[model samples]
Target: MQAILQSSDTELDIVRALRENCERPFEDAHAMPPAVYTSEAFLALERRDVFRTEWLCVGRASALANCGDYLSAQIDDQPVFVLRDASGALRAFSNVCLHRMSVLLEGRGNVRRIVCPYHAWNYTLDGSLAAAPLMDRQPGFCKEQYKLPAVRCETWQGWIYVTLNEHAPAVESHLSELSKLIEPYGMGDYVETFHEEHVWDTNWKILAENFMESYHLPMLHRATVGPHSRLEEMECPPGSPAFNYHWITKEASLPIGNAHPTNTRLEGHWRRTTALLAIYPTHLVTLTPGYFWYLILQPQGVGRVHIRFGGGLAPEFVDDPQAAGYMATLKTLLDEVNAEDRRGVEAVFRGVHAPLAKPGHLSPLERPNYDFARYLAGRLGAT
Candidate 1:
């Protein structure tokens, strides 16, 4: 472990800064240093120590409802894809072609076969090499011998997670406590009505930390959701090993932001409460009574992040006569919120590059950010 994390001096400096942050008391803890986000060496360390070893969420399983629908993604440089097979079971595998190493798929869509563009070689929905054109003419080139490598794909409460580490703990087992706490929201049943992919100019950790804290909601989002976010109404308890969370009661601009009238699981003020969850490295979910939305982050080097953004109505709101209206309102609000966040996170990325840039002290509202910093440090720290 030390050899992996301590491979380079620059990375060692960044990890030391992170450990220093973790060593402080709650009131005294500061933000992690800028190098954690800007250092290529440190990003390389995370590529090995964090992304390769964690259960990274791709998107919601609801987005891949039909057979052959697949989501393509990467961990470090290893390209992978996850799809719902013809048998209706979800599976993931290397996206690279076995013939000439072309990526079998690009982006998400329904397909009859995973065809390589470089060559005509194709694969079944289950990742079996279905056809390798003209390969039969070659000696001893069995199609079975060229099947795409399998990867571990797991569904945790409707979210699709894939990991390169076969020895990693089960997704369900890792988030069991979080499941119990968020059970009343019926998160697994919310069908995703919208899914999108975008690349943003910001460090992935900066974006992850942005989603982890609501301290800036009243100011950064003042033109949008800021007015509804009252700091006093928020709750940030100590985070657990696998994740961190915070909650706030919202006076919604969209009715769907609150619990639907048909919702019975939530009573009183619980209907207007929203739970913000940071599941380990990169899965951030805003689970509300009437709807839910999430961001699955993937780092593109040290300065850019590839984001899978999506959301949908809760089970109660999905069946309402006004479901279309709710979906429209939710999408509009999300677009606005994302625009605001994009501006904010991108600015922070620029600021981090300044010569005097350094992490500052944290507020109580930034507890989740503190926890997230520690999570990053813990992952890249030496044994």
Candidate 2:
């Protein structure tokens, strides 16, 4: 682990600035300008300055557990292919074929060679161009020069992340504080159970802000999550590093009494707690007692976003029928909650475009939201 920088006076100054301005109380519910969520210029700036520069989670390491396994994905519209080489080490490369810019792979599968259907070009799992149908007759064609371009890839806590910018600092550097915050959860020991993906009509920020606070539980998710969880039990403590926020929410125990609503359980089999971690610009991880769920938000456009939910269980619980069943139940509950939020977020998205719409202030409970907005503003060069 790299040492936390404490020697440079400048480092302390940066920390001080964050401690001060970043936590300032949000004044009005309208402090965030509506333009930030609906403007094309702002979205373009984020695509370049935020999405392209950060280490974004691409998939779970377990996705490529076997030597020949591979998965093709897009991060912020940039094509990428991840594979486990013959040596068993994982690598990521731009999926675009060098010869004619064709995508090398379309979906997930195991393959000995990535053969481009467009031109019969083939490359090994390690990204070396092994064969080109007519390269021998083509002038200026060199095997060494046709290898797929590589991207910066790293694995931490059993998750794989890739960065588009070659010059960006190591992933660990950017995730330093976040790593420490999540280390206690034993995330590396978790094995995936199921994966879910969906597209939302609202801006990604709206979804993020919704997760940062539980104040809406009493209203939005009363049947799904509200009765089980309490606002007082969801604590968002201070001292988050720049670009991230951390919180702990006591899991709602099954409700009791005939007075409790129908269709909602009054008693669950076990009590669970959730440690929530939000990494700015688009990653959300919920560390539960039995499993963890990670949400990766991909911005498709100013008003569209793709959310991928990956759920995992501890290695010991992977084969436990009860644990696996519970995880499935949890996934269903989360899906219901997300569905409710989607409706409201979409409404907000449309309302924000109205002529009467304006920036909103932050609630004391929403300090994290304010912190995130500040971080976004800084990264978008709006600060």
Candidate 3:
């Protein structure tokens, strides 16, 4: 790992503390030590054991419906791009050009080929080297052998996931139970309507922990979702090896849409409930009756995270004549809710840096939070 991302003595001590806490029972477990949020060495370890090895969700396949659509991102700080090839297959490759190591693309766009601006080297949509100016003059240089290295890519329920680890389990296998739990939501058919990326001034885990539980809703989101939150009705079941989930039931509301018309198949409290899930490392999603939204997190450092925020309406709402207008209203509402979360979580990040910062007791409502700590500990090889 680079020195910029390495850990310090204080950080190593925090990792030791986390290992001790992981040995305790869930009921006796406290929150993760504050240094875990601000330690560069700890972040380096997480990048190796968690982000680089897990099936990190990049975006939805629907975002690249047409051939040649591509999106670029830094997976564990490694430049990579996912694109649809001419044959309609989704593929991922190192965004680095094989020749000079310059990034081949930026952001998302429709492209027939990836051209490196640094040296004019180009690659096909499938990452095979297409053209290398004057390379024919270089003796014994083989164009075929210079193709960009492939990254492991998979899709589950319309979402695209990529893992840098060749040995990682398939995305579907990892989310098998989660798939059945959310089968009624028809997420495979959900159409993404909006996406926005933001760089937040907070540790990735801090933001993810906040996302997994609604305990802070009544306080942090007091002006937005706080009013409608049914904290007492929240239920967080134990997590499986691949994921953890919690449920909260509440009456339906508008602008965000209510019980999806085609979703009448769900029964009783399920009709009024939402499932919030954290898929291991960093894919966070909320499955509801009418719509679904997710946060795909990428840790930039100990104190910063990159987030891809997106969501979509159910089939019924997507078919509605006023779909666009309704979506606009919902986007505004969700943006406000996200802004509220950012402000609150950023403050927590600042607090985590204090010398006296210590792990506090968790509440029953923080069951998912407790589960998260265990997952992290296990990934970090904590006994």
Candidate 4:
């Protein structure tokens, strides 16, 4: 096993400084300036130095379960496509036609050839230039020179990751600690059950930081998550690898006693061993007995984020299509909880924009969010 990279004394000092500066009283949460939420300049910098260089989860491997299956998506404004070719090898591409710079596929489907709509230029599922409308008419047209541009794609624990840079290192090299962190739960065996897209009117970082801490659950999601999950019971395992942390919370268990008076069938469903794990940048994997939810947050712009929530169920449940309905019901319940969070975050965004705001202190209970912010600041070359 490779040795985990230890944080140097300088890194520890930085952490201490961040903890001291960011952690303040509850009233200070609103003190954080609006720039963190609304600065276009900061967003552009993050896109170039942070998102561009990081390994980002784009889709799930199961999305391409059969031969010739493919999905097209945009990662941080860069167009990319994921496909399982005829030979069953998963591949990713720039999703742009080599001929005239047009997108080859708009959505997901099974295709023997990816034909560009702007022209009849077609490429094989493997991204080879298979056909062109009238290449012979163009004297200098060369099939080899016009093949689709390929991107670096890899799969880990059933999730698909793509990087825009051709020469970027392998995904494993960057996700040094992720494998061990997820191994305990047998993540590879879980099946996806629910998936949805939500638009958040805040920076992707804000959403990420919000998730790293359970401090807000009591206030923001009092009805759903608060009664069951408590900050005191939330466990942040020590000696966790940098940029990634492992946590196990018992509060995720369903409510009991008086809390159960108005409990519905859904409460019994959610009570089943709910586990949450987040990989850096924008992937959050949460598991429960009834379903597995994988969230991928894509930054659309400075003030907008596209959130994809994919749910996977146990294989036994998936064998019967009817079971998917149960999963859908769970998703609906979650949608309500998420809607509450969305409104709260939007309110925070508005408050941060006020001229009275400043960088706030971090609470000891909010160590996870503070750590995450420090990680982001380090990656974006911020102090």
Candidate 5:
């Protein structure tokens, strides 16, 4: 095993400086200290205070619609798997086996029982110990006491969320107000059509901050989204406890297949707008008239993040005869935008690590960046 990184007073000083900067007014606020981005010590602090304790969005619950469907992932280094049990309920369990601590599952699959590759000890879909061959001779062994451990799991608006914190609030209670803001989009009725995972070579915060604001659209995405975006038309409301959203309104330039059959209830601006929101800690999403896309971020270390990227169209679009053909165009567009973002943010990561790097003033357009910084500061101070 690799040796654990230890924090020194110098690192704590960096954390203190970042907290101070986060408390500054938006006009006076600067970015977080460079150390906060490049230091493993600081990442450790965030893992303990933020990632481990906060409710994290994993994926859409609809993805695991069948009884035996399951998705496996690492939540802050804790091997975990979420499955739909025989009763058709979503469940999450430590992917680690009880016998010799072997990981019980990998990626996504449909399994009747989870069997450990190292030892044949198996667990049922509901996380109960099912079988342990050749263990009858053990003096005090008891299968009942060896069932796989469960972690807290919840679903809200068809999205799956899991938290390692035992005392965390219910996902719905935290997101109820945000639901009101998104109800107009009929987000719940949208079916996921594309899902992919990629590991980015940049700090998680860099990408998180990048996705939360559109200030870069005019420059970073010049070849694609730039021409369509007008920074002056953006409306970033004040940050709230659950999430922060900003609107970007622009008329459709080119029709891919069909106009998004948006709800008539949505008015003028809503008809041509996209709301980009960051649900604090990690879940970042964008809701548009015809479709939605989301990014579920998992920090692998100070320099890497595992991203769960997914997008889907409204029920109307899904029912369209050309749905498949339209989705092909949509996926291509998303991939191009993602590539543009990847290049931009990775460049920022390199700059952040330079010896002369320092926090710079933030633009008003980067309100989400400010909100994200405050959220990180709050997490650092909690507990």
Candidate 6:
């Protein structure tokens, strides 16, 4: 009894600390408490209130152009899939076999139908149970009554989002203001050329906070992007109810980071500007004039994270002769930057577990992190 009480008290302390941090003025803001990242009870609260109810992004809508192209993902513990049905409409459904309750799909692919490998109980492209072999002997068995339960799915800009909660607000309206802000970039028209998933040894929020701020770019990523970053030029504005963003304008070292030579959509400094958008819960995007990349994060217990990572070229650069070269260069730089972030975030996670570790003061460049702390605290009912 005493041990559990101690744990609960510790969690409450962290929550209060977070609320206090969010209330502080920007000049006195602080990073999140270490306990916020290490508590299993807090993760359960987030899974119920945040992950289950939020509009979680699965991937780019362009990835499922064909009638039967499907992508499978696990939201916290619930397995789900997003696909384009025969009617050429986007759809999402619970990816579980009704018979033995096995997961139906594994990864991204084109399929004429979804078949359960366990018992050969198959479903059509629309998720209607097409057949149930060896079930003729079962009494009162009706296949029509066993269609896969549909999940709420929507598209905002060009990205696909699925939510377990049917009553969650529509993704488009929730992010409409953000859409208008970046409309000139034509994000909806970008083409995804590469995608890969990896698990990292850090709390999900750690990686998210890393993406939210560029304060560590000078020292942590000095070998790659650090030299080009100017701390004084970055703009960290107040975030909206659903998202936070920062801007960095630079004479990009990588040709693809700046506007391509043929590009005319962006004039003047817009050509060299980069937008780092942190969509609530766990979507982060690095949008430049020539290309874009994003991370869709989910917690793997309290100690690690599952990252859905991908990127691609802007419409202007997609079909050009140098498209392949640009793709290669972007992938290489992204890989290098990712390596740096992994090291930095993993170290922070390690440090958080130390006995004397605590939340530190935030730099002005870390305004996005401050906003993110408020978002997390608010969702967890701490604010």
Consecutive 10-residue window with the lowest summed lDDT within model 3: 1-10
Off by over 4 Å in 5: 1-8, 254-259, 262-267
Candidate order by lDDT, decreasing, is 6, 1, 3, 5, 2, 4
lDDT per residue, candidate 6, 1-383, as tens digits?
99888867776777787888899897898888887888887787788779988899989999999999999997778899989999999999899999999999999998898999899899998789999997878888988889998989999879999898777779999899999889888889898988899999999999999999988999999998898778998999999879999998888766778888888888899999999999988999999998899999989899989899999988878877887897798788889999999999999999999999978789888888888888888887532
Looking at candidate 1, the ten consecutive residues that score lowest on lDDT are 1-10
Off by over 4 Å in 1: 1-7
Error of model 4, residue 233, in angstroms: 1.7
Candidate 4 regions exceeding 4 Å error are 1-33, 238-243, 246-273, 316-326
- Give one digit per residue, the lDDT tens place, for model 5 in 1-383: 13332355655777789888988888898877888889887888889898889898888887898988999887788999999999889999999988889998987778888999998998888888888998888979888887778899998878888999989889899898888887777677778887899999999999998998888999999998898788899988778766788987777543422236545646666777777889988898887777778998999888898999998877777777876786788788889999999999899899998999888899898877887777787777477
Q: Count the backbone clashes (under 3 Å) in each candidate.
A: 0, 15, 2, 15, 0, 0
Scored by lDDT, model 6 comes in at 0.89
Per-candidate TM-scores read 0.96, 0.84, 0.94, 0.81, 0.94, 0.96
Per-residue lDDT tens digits for candidate 3, residues 54-163, read: 88899988899999999998788789999999999999999999987898899889999899989999999878899999999999889998788899999999999998
User: Which stretches in model 6 have alpha-carbon errors above 4 Å?
Assistant: 1-10
Clashing pairs in 1: none
The candidate with the higher lDDT, 1 or 5, is 1
Weakest 10 consecutive residues of candidate 5 by summed lDDT: 253-262
Better by lDDT, candidate 6 or 4: 6
Q: Model 6: clashing residue pairs?
A: none
